[model samples]
Every structure is written in C-alpha cells, then in structure tokens.
Target: MVEPNFSSGRAAERPDAAVGSAPLAEPAAGAAIDPSKEPEGRKETKHLSRSRLIWRRYWRSAGGKIGLVGLAVILLLALIGPSLALWDYWVVDDNAFLSMPSGDHWFGTNQGGFDVFAMTVEGLRKSLVIGFAVAAIVEILAALIGASAAYFGKKVGMVLQWITDLLLVVPSFLIIAIISQHTAGSKSSTWLLIILLAAFSWMISARVIRAMTLSLVNLDYVTAAKFMSVPSLVVIVKHVIPNVASYLIIDFTLGVVGAIMSETTLSFFGFGVQKPETSLGTLLGDGMASATTSPWIFLFPAGVLVVLLLCVNFVGDALRDAIDPSSKSGGAA
Candidate 1:
C-alpha cells in the first residue's frame, strides 16, 4: 500500500551531538519530550480540528458569495423553467406568443405566436444537453491524448502534438461549417458536429494536461508507484488524474460553455440547426429578423441565452478558484 509522503516534524536524533560532557538521554514515559524525532528537535504539529478550521476559513471573499448566488439562480431556472414548459416548443399560440410580459406570460411572446418563456426554457434544456455532451467528449478525448503523449513520448507523440498544433491555427468555425454542409443536415449531422467540435477542441487541453503529467511523472512519489509495479493505467487513473482533476473540471466547463455559444452562433448565422426545429439559437435568429418591429422576439431569447452563458462562466470560475490552492485562504475551523 502507498503511504502519504507528507512530512512530519519529528525525526530521529543523531548520537554525535553531545552537550558539555554528558550525552542526552531518552526521557521517561509520560515525561515532556521534543515533538520532532530528528536531531533538529522540532515538535510535531497537530492537525487542526475540523470544525475550528472550517470556521476560520468561511469568510474568504465577496466573489465566492456572488458566485454561489449566481449558480443557485441558474440551477433553479434550469430546473423550474423546464418543468413549467408545458407547450410544444414550435407550436404557434396567439396567447402564448407576442404577448407582453405579465403574470400569464412571464417573458412575453414571439412572432410565431409560441410562448417565448416555454420555448426559451426548452431551448435551455437543449443547450445544456449539447454543452454537457460536447464537454464530456472533449475532456475524455483530451485526457487520453495527453496521457498517451506524456506516458509514451517519441515520434508518435511528437507527430500527434504537431498535428494538434496545426489544427489549433485553423478557424474552427470554417472547418465545422464545411463538415456540416457536406453531411446534408441529417440527424447524424448534429451528433457528428458535436464529435468533430469536441475532437478539435481537445487538442489544447491535451497539451496542457501533457505538460502537467510530464512534470508529475518525474516526482519521487510517482516514481515510487512505478517501482511498486503498479499498472501504468491504474497509476495514471488514480495518481495522475486526481492531482490534475481541478484543471480538467474547469477546462470542461469552459469548453461546454464555448461549445454551446458556438452552436448558438452557428445556428443564428443559418449554418446551424435548420428551420422548423428550434434551439435558443434559432429563436434568437428569428427574433432578430423582426426585432426592429417586435423587439420582444429578440430580447427575451437573447437575454436568456446571455444569462445562461454568463451563469455557466461564473460557476466555472468559482469552481476553479475554489479548487486552486492559491485562491483558497482560510482553513475551516
């Protein structure tokens, strides 16, 4: 079994150090003694009490509170808004669409006569689903690529890294557009779009992770694990990932938020989700056309989209900060 490498203050004393003519002798049981075992005579420090540490650390900063509140609001909206979206996303109902904001219609209506609020809620669901799927795929792909490169460095790793670098220079939108157009808008196209985006996006993350893994691989603890004959995969999974998980989580959130926004932008520009099937992007696009005459169409959908994106970014930042040792200040009392 692996043991923690954390240093304890205590250390064994050396016999060579003598005081005056008499040598130091071991103390009797229950007598006062030095905390450290080493000749340095350092005392061992006690771990902080959990409750005391928690109390000491509670008031970190104002930003954390704001982040928490924003996260909660987004979560509540995600859950409640979708649950209350009863009507068909595409269905045109006069009362539902183009109606002014009131108790009956919280977000007012759209040109197609569909409830803007319901459609927005439904759109959020779709956006979130796509975002999560894209992020997960990207993170997994990146982690694997990074691990492969770092663990087995050679021509293969160099070539792969080079390819990733090359891809990074290209405009992502153009490539995705070309691919989407070639597929002819089938159901497969959407999934393919997601996969392609994720594949391309993973390169940067993989490179970052590779750098981190490379540094960690040389550490004594990691070398010891290797010496212990642990399987490479297990070691990577258990030791490597846990150490870098904070970066991965933050990277994933950033990727997902970007993917969702990119999807929305593409759809808005008519290179994305086709007519009839609506996403937040589609709603925003339609809203823009008649926006001058009926600003509600644009305002409601765009507002929600902005809020959703901002919320995601905020939460992502919070998590990153919370996990980062530098940002964390107080220990829990």
Candidate 2:
C-alpha cells in the first residue's frame, strides 16, 4: 500500500490502454449487420406467401416432381399424338388387319383394322376431358353445398346434411349405370355421363367440406365479413372456400382418377361412351376378346391408363403432404 503501483499507474495514464479497456459502442440503428457474426436462428429472413410456401414444399417432394413431369408428358402426347399416327382412330386399314406394330402402323392394327396408336390417343384425350370436367363440377358442388350448409345451420344445414346422408347410403354406381345406359344414345351423352359421375361423386367430399366449413365459419374474418352485410354467397366463395382450397385441390386430383376409372368401368361394360366415340375403357373391352390372340391391343391402352393413374396418385399424395404442416413427407419448408 505504501509503494506506488507503476504498471497500474501506467495503464491508467496510457490512451491505448484506456481504449482497450473501454466498452464497445453500440451499433447504429441503420448499420448493416455482419452476417458472419449473426447468432444462429437470428439471421435476416424473407417471408413467403401461402401459395409460394405450398409450391415450395410441393416442388421439393420427389413424388411431386415425378408426377408433374409424367403428367406434362402425358398431356403432350394426348394433344399431338393423333397427328403423329398414320391413320385416324376410326379409319379402317383394309390391308393391315390385326397386324403387329410396324413402321407404317405403329402400335399395330386391331381386329377391325383400326390403328391402335390412334385409338389409344383418342381414348386418352376423351378420358382426360371427362375426368377434368367431372372433377371441376364435383369440387364446385361440394364447396357450394357444404359451405352453405355449415354457414346457415339449423333448418338448411339439417336438410343439406340429410341429402348428403341419403346420397351416401344410396347405391351411386347402380344409379349412374342405369342413368348412363338410358342416355347413352343421346348426342350429349358424353356430357350427361360427366354430369352423372359428378353428381354421385361429390357426396362424401361435401360432408368433408361441411366439417371444414363448420370450423371456419366462426373465425374472426368470417364473422367480420358477415357483420359487414356481405352477401352469404360472397362470403362463402371469397372467404370460406379459399380457406379449404388446399383440400379441394387434393380432392380434385383424386377425383380425376376416380372419374376416369368410373367412366372406364361403365364403358367397358357397354354402359358409357357409345360407339363412334371411344374411351380407354371401350378400347380395353374391345381388346379383351383378342388379348390372347393379339396382346398389343390390350397392352397399349392399358399401359397409358396405368401411367396416368399413377401420376395422378403421386400428385395427390404430394399435395396432401405439402398442405398439411404436420406431414414430414414434403421435407423441410
């Protein structure tokens, strides 16, 4: 205590020492942050909109990539395939009856001398059209009926629910089969078939939509819209349906597959898609008789149908996983 501390005194007197000992100044309000020094999980981030986020997750999925590519290729084939064929689907090649695949007649000719390639392309196009049409109708009907039922509960809800329940228990396939058979000869039979398929297919989906709407109708935004004197239809369409759009999208994908299968079944049994207009099912039915004698007829159309259905299933699975935050199959967002 009696002796002076030279080092301590020097340290106190030294400007460099004082500088070293002083606390660091705070960063300016608008200074650029050094990314390297940022703490984990505190780095600057960009926000993603719901659509973008869903697309990001879906694109990251292996199934989604495969499905999308496969679908695109199939669509391309459907659009331009007929032009590539040597003969029209219904045109008979008198000389090349029941022939195997060749340079002139790719995919061979059936018993009727019709080009297999051309028939397959036509069938694919028709099936796709019907599938998309039916799916659209089903989604629209389900959304409107289900959302309306949930929003206007009590008498209207009960009636809608009753209708849904009735449809659920009814033999839809039998009803559709009977109706399609009766209308098979009409000029608008194809459209009629699509409508029939859509009518029966939406019941289960409507129930699901109703359940979703019940949860959504009381949300703050929905309530606000209602209080603002917005029309009921406008509120349901703008607010309620959008909230359930993910499910609707997934349902639409699956619905396409189902509609195609249904149409195929009906056509195979001669109840749907009458002659002069062919479908995959009709081709399969015609080919079944010659399967053993000529496998090409059965194989080509069968292959296309399998591929289309598989792609649809993959897309549906990917969509479901992408939409569900709890699902891990879509990988990290």
Question: Which candidate gets the maximum lDDT versus the true structure?
Answer: 2
Per-residue lDDT, model 2, residue 93, is: 91
Q: How close is every model to the real structure, measured as TM-score?
A: 0.74, 0.89
Residue lDDT tens for model 2, 230-308: 9999999999999999899999999999999999999999988988789999999999999999999999999999999
lDDT of 1 by residue, 1-333 (tens): 998644421222444655344545668989875545556546455687644443334335354456557757766776788567655566677655467776766677776677778877777766776788899998888877787677666786798798889988989888887777777447676677677678668888999999888877777887899899999888778777777787898898798788898889877887666555567887888888878887877888888778777767766765565565466543322
Local distance difference test, per candidate? Answer: 0.73, 0.92
lDDT score, candidate 2, position 130: 96
